[model samples]
Target chain A: METGTAAHDDAAREPVWTGLPPGLLKMRRLLLVVWLGLLTVVLGALLNLFAGPAWAAFALLPLALIVWGWVLLGRNWRSWRYAERADDLLISRGVLWHHETIVPYGRMQLVEVTSGPVERHFGLASVQLHTAAAATDATIPGLVPAEAERLRDRLTELGEARSAGL
Target chain B: MTTPGAEKDVPEAAEVVREQVPVVERRLHPVTPLRRAWAPVAVIIGWAVHDPNQAQEQLTRLTTITLLIGLAVFVPAAGLYGFLTWWFTHFSVTDTELRIRTGLLFRRTAHIRLERIQAVDVTQPLLARVAGVAKLKLDVVGTDKKDELAFLGEGEARALRAELLARAAGFAPETVHDVGEAPSQQLLHVPAGVLAVSLVLTGATWGSLAAALVVPPLLWLATHSVWTVLATALPLLGAAGASSVGRFVGEYDWTLGESPDGLRIDHGLLDRTHETVPPGRVQTVRIVEPLLWRRRGWVRVELDVAGSSNSVLVPVAPREIAESVVARVLPGVTVPPLPALSRPPRRAHWCVPLWWRGYGLAVTDTVFAARHGLLRRSLALVPHAKVQSVRLKQGPWERFWRLAEVHVDTGANGTVTARLRDAEEAAELLREQAERSRTGRRDARPDRWMA
Candidate 1:
């Protein structure tokens, strides 16, 4: 029950209404689990070749972490929520220990849209908002390219108008 | 946060006309050519050093041929290239903006509005100092990018800085330069003993880590493990000490004084650094009292300005001096009133025994202040208008105990704010802060730049 840095909320603290693309969760899980599976294979081979079955026990730690993470990633994905308010944007994420980041529309200096090869393959992109204060800066991941562009333009327009008031 | 030059009555077309009229257009100093040719000179030296035998043997021929070739090819080419770069790099100050144009081919220009200049940094690096030039970096309020004018004459840099700051404060620029009088006060100085102690503390941390990692092998191989350990540790400790001493020397002779434009600081042992925190740009201020200096009542005052870091207002000083600095730099904002803070919940005793009792929060009409720490007490002052966001948090145990904490942010990077305890209270506090932040920014007076 680690307490994360989160902003004000009612006692119930209902989940935010917005979410990432539905396909994003499955993609993230596959990417992580595939890598972990490969590591398990490599570790098992090395341990058996060098130190035999007794030393092979060392492989359990990473294997346990991978298994735990693969199962909990669904919760982590569900945790990510972003809400666009009239004056600011709220980004809340983290599974066991929840964290929330709030970035004001007025404080936004630059809104960038970026997509890596993997994300592009999945037809997704991320929008990053840069601010003078690093901590308040926020990024929204797993939006479609068109949606990312729309958000960037909309945010940039709002930023210019409200900047004088930040 | 008010937009500069965008206040009620100014027309957009008037600004366009103002942009066409330049107040001062000056090329960088003559030494800029030589400075720009550093890469070529370094390459030439590397060629000479690569093979001393061949270089020295044919010294006369090499000298004549290279000199002729250098005169014919490299000198003219490097000189022309450097000269072109220098010619292209010109800065102009307009009534409402500062325009810097550079680049030969791409032809890029950066125009910073007069009121948007958040912080002005005057830095004299080694080469620039030797060449009698300094660099000026203008940090804008909302943008992370800084507009810089490199290699202005030192006097010119100071005059420009003073003028820019004065202009931002809505004063006659000429008056700031002509006043010739030194500023009002000098607050604190890092004594030699403090500097030595700071060095030792830094050295001990770095030195011990290095010794721990490096000594084991030496101990295993050497006949006398203790001597080997000592031998390894001495050099590591000396290196760390020397490095810290060098940094202290670079930032030495630090002096802060009151000026019409803002609270000005003139310091830096080797290369001078002149920084001004204009009237309203100061975002957050923190007062810290280290444990070692507890009995002596020494403390440090650090602050953050929008769009800039390097906010060390005071390295170390007496508590009185720290308070005085806070008074001068951050006017109007005051210490937190203790009455606002209720007793900490019973659960806080274990994790934050020292801090629990001293922790406090108070909101005045214009500002909110948070106080924490026991022996090393720290008080953070942030105005309602400056608040960027607010947070309420509860650790697992805190949740079990129905305790919560509230965090307020002001867009000042690396600022620290304690969360409030008691869930309902924390929620109420956050909501109140958010509303205050909105109304506060709406009705707040414009900053120097925006005014």
Candidate 2:
């Protein structure tokens, strides 16, 4: 089928939305803070090598404290979101620069529902949809367990109906 | 389009039905006895060889230290393995789908519907054969993903094969014929002349034999003592004997069988490998004759397939047989007729590089070769679907005449390269072939073709 044909008008009209689980963002920020802290400590040590002992001593405490603060704030700053429209599932999130990906349901090949230990404890889950084409795939994270299951069923049904020449 | 308000076009309200459907069956793969013993063996060996005097060591009483360390590492590892065995050893085949769930920490479950499966190839490695198990590789069309459901009992493999074929037949009426039926007939078999020619052209057969005889003497000379010769030569002799046995077993036991489902090739001596390729999934077919094999009239048949990208199916047979087999598997995909065979223009003497010439240059060369067809010299170049890229190559000498060769890469399995000695001609040919491949339909459509 020609992808540009009028038959795909419905897909073009769909709005995109996405939401990531809070735990995932928290996990990412925790990693970033730890990395930043390590960088600061390494930089302080390198500066100690070049500067006089007094300068090294003066820099170490403040650098360590700043790193610690970053680590503390990172744990609290995690979050994500999603929205579904007529034709696409839009996912948006990032600590630094936000990214938005729109995935069309018709392109979906497989839908997977997964739960991690934290998600399990919180009764939450994530749904990932794979596409035949490498690009244009998306995952929606941080849904309530029941919502994730419902979405999985709906996506699977929609994928199958579309594949069957709907 | 029908009128919006027509009785047939009236929208019907969705009906609601309440039913209790069973949850999808969960399955875990069975743990092999060898795998279960591997960790314990490694732990015991490590404990026996561990040296405490190294800089990394902790000072402690050896017996107590070993016991504590072993318990700390082995206990959790064994327990985790046991848990994994329980969790991932299961698999389930429902009425309409197959599901494989695996992984310990991040559990992964893959599901494939019966209707989507294009072919199922049952492969048995050495361990699988000894364990009475086989791996089912299901290739589904319209998707690039490959799902491997392993450790099926040999009996289960057969049952699954029949069930899958039956389901396929139900969806596609053309496949209603018994899958067990043999193919119409094999178009070619390795002819004796071809075998002789292959043995001469490629010195591998004789070289192997020569190596077998020379290794013992070579070892004996190296050791310089009659008593030590036995120690040195015995291993070499054993290895050579084993290799010869392997070769013999492979040559004699090799069978290429044809069935309605696909072409089945089974070979190997101690560790047999069985591979099947349904015509539908074969992306491309190539007939190649290496320079050395030219005089012997031997050609290698290779097929590109979806699931077996890492492996190429090469059947060495007579040139004529190779042509016939290619025609049967892929019709109307071979190069057009040529006049006669001639010695390839002297490679060293050609004034301008001919390798880069367009179709016209190739035609001229083919026409020259056609005059001497009985000499057994000819080259056929066939391009496959979708020429995605074209590359031109030339060595330093050819660069003198602004000459370059062309190689066209297609989406198909095998590499389709053409050598044109003339750069301008090669460019023109590349353009023509690329355009033709883009517009033409594939020679064999997967949906209809069957072995």
Candidate 3:
């Protein structure tokens, strides 16, 4: 077959998208704010050492990125949503320049559920699905540990069933 | 990160056979074990060579006696360590899974489900070949961790590989031996002479060889021909040459064929390697034709399997043969028709690095093919069912020029991102590819057995 029909033109309704946990917005802001604060402080001290108050204004660059990041963090978190369809998992993320990733059940070889020390402090975890492809940037972060485990189990079950079934 | 520690129920007949086999515990080859003693022997020789005149003049009774005592203690200790290692690492094959248990202190066990097994590769290193042993490497689908039984008797390795394949393919135990020798049709063969010549012709391989040869002179210049430099450079020279030879061993006499088990590959001249890539194990197929090989119409076929990033099926073969192999592996994927388009009004071609080189991409009935590369031409086929995600990338320059790139990411393998001069066309390709992938996965029977 050389050519096939375009498949998305017939969709009647927008795909139902589920946004990320609101707690992630707070986590991201906290991390970015701390990081930016440390960077600005370090740069501020270095500026003081090198050129004094003449370069104090240059510290504003990090502040700008931090402020920009703070605002975009919420938007990015808001933009993060996953749609669990019948056969594939769709993860839409990013703001300004949007990205949507679809991982089919049959393509999944492993479902990993992990929680770092920071995420654990927030009682949040992430679920990562590994396919045959090397780089898998399709992870659903900021989910509750219980929810993450449940998703991991469900995806694993679906992966096994679909892969063997295929 | 997680291990499949639990065992599932296996067929009763198979279970009985597993118990009868009595859990085989095998050791690695003795070459590594013998290395333990040889290392000290080398050190002793090196020590004496350091100051022969001084050593002879200063050959005090205490020092000579100390040397004797040191050798006596070190040799036994190294032997003990080697024996413990050989005793500890062992793997057993049961009906439902292959279990590997290793470690002398902290016990670690890995259980691989039979259904998840992909391919079994039988390889023998030059050293191992002299000892009449082979390594059976099991490649499981979807995981990087490879299960290997190293340095086994040739017959045992063959038997184990057949049994593993039989278990993986859901075949009865009684028929595994018969299936191992299933009639296979030869597809392509590269004579050893051709392989050697090609190695020298490939710029990358030749570059490495030249670099390896140049190092000794470089070191001579740096060290002024010192003995210490000889010791260090000798290994570097030995290693580089050894690796080049190893590559030759692995790829020489390459033969690709098809059999009942799946794709059968037999390569290597001195150390023969017999590998079986079971049907449906391949994740992605790439047909690469280097600049030098283009005139000869030779293409290299590589597969991105669950096992390796670039598992080459054929290093160099006629284009027609390579095409047939690709067609067989990926039943219904094809190259796009000629006269490729450069979208976003040809004016935007300024954003692309090489506008005159041309771009080749097409959305086929069941797959997306992107064929573009200046010096090294390649055709990447991503079936709609195998598409992991579709991404549209527009850099600031591309945006100004009204162009974008559509990155078609297939799992594990690299992305086939086509930089098109048209943004709308890129978006359309993304939407269409994602949609096709969605619908294809929905309708396609993903089960291997069903196929």
Q: Would you list the C-alpha lDDT of every candidate in the order shown? A: 0.70, 0.51, 0.70
By summed lDDT, which 10 consecutive residues of candidate 2 chain B come out lowest? B365-374
Question: What TM-score against the true fold does each predicted structure earn?
Answer: 0.70, 0.51, 0.76
Expressed as tens digits, the lDDT of each residue in B1-451 for candidate 3 is 1122222244564455545665555565655455334555676678888878776766664576787998689889878766665577778776568887766687877787876666778888777788788887777744444357666787778777777777676665445456565578988888877777666667777666676678778888887878866776677666666656767777888988987667888888777888887776665677787889878777788886665433889987878877878877776655453454232356555755564255667677777777777688777777776676666666656667767777777654667767653777776676667668656666543323312
**Model 3 compared with the native: what TM-score?**
0.76
> Comparing chain B with the reference, what is the TM-score for each candidate?
0.76, 0.62, 0.78
Higher-scoring candidate on DockQ, 1 or 2:
1
Q: If you assessed candidate 2 against the hidden native complex, which CAPRI class would it receive?
A: incorrect
Worst 10 residues of 1 chain A by lDDT: A1-10
Chain A only: list TM-scores of all candidates. Answer: 0.77, 0.54, 0.79
Candidates sorted on DockQ, descending? 3, 1, 2
Pick the DockQ winner. 3
Question: After TM-score superposition, what is the CA distance of residue B404 in candidate 1 from its true location, in Å?
Answer: 5.9
The digit string of per-residue lDDT tens for model 2 on B83-195 reads 56555655665544667666667777777775555456676777778888776777664433335756567776766666555544343222332443334344344444444
Docking class of 3: acceptable
User: DockQ (C-alpha) of model 1?
Assistant: 0.28
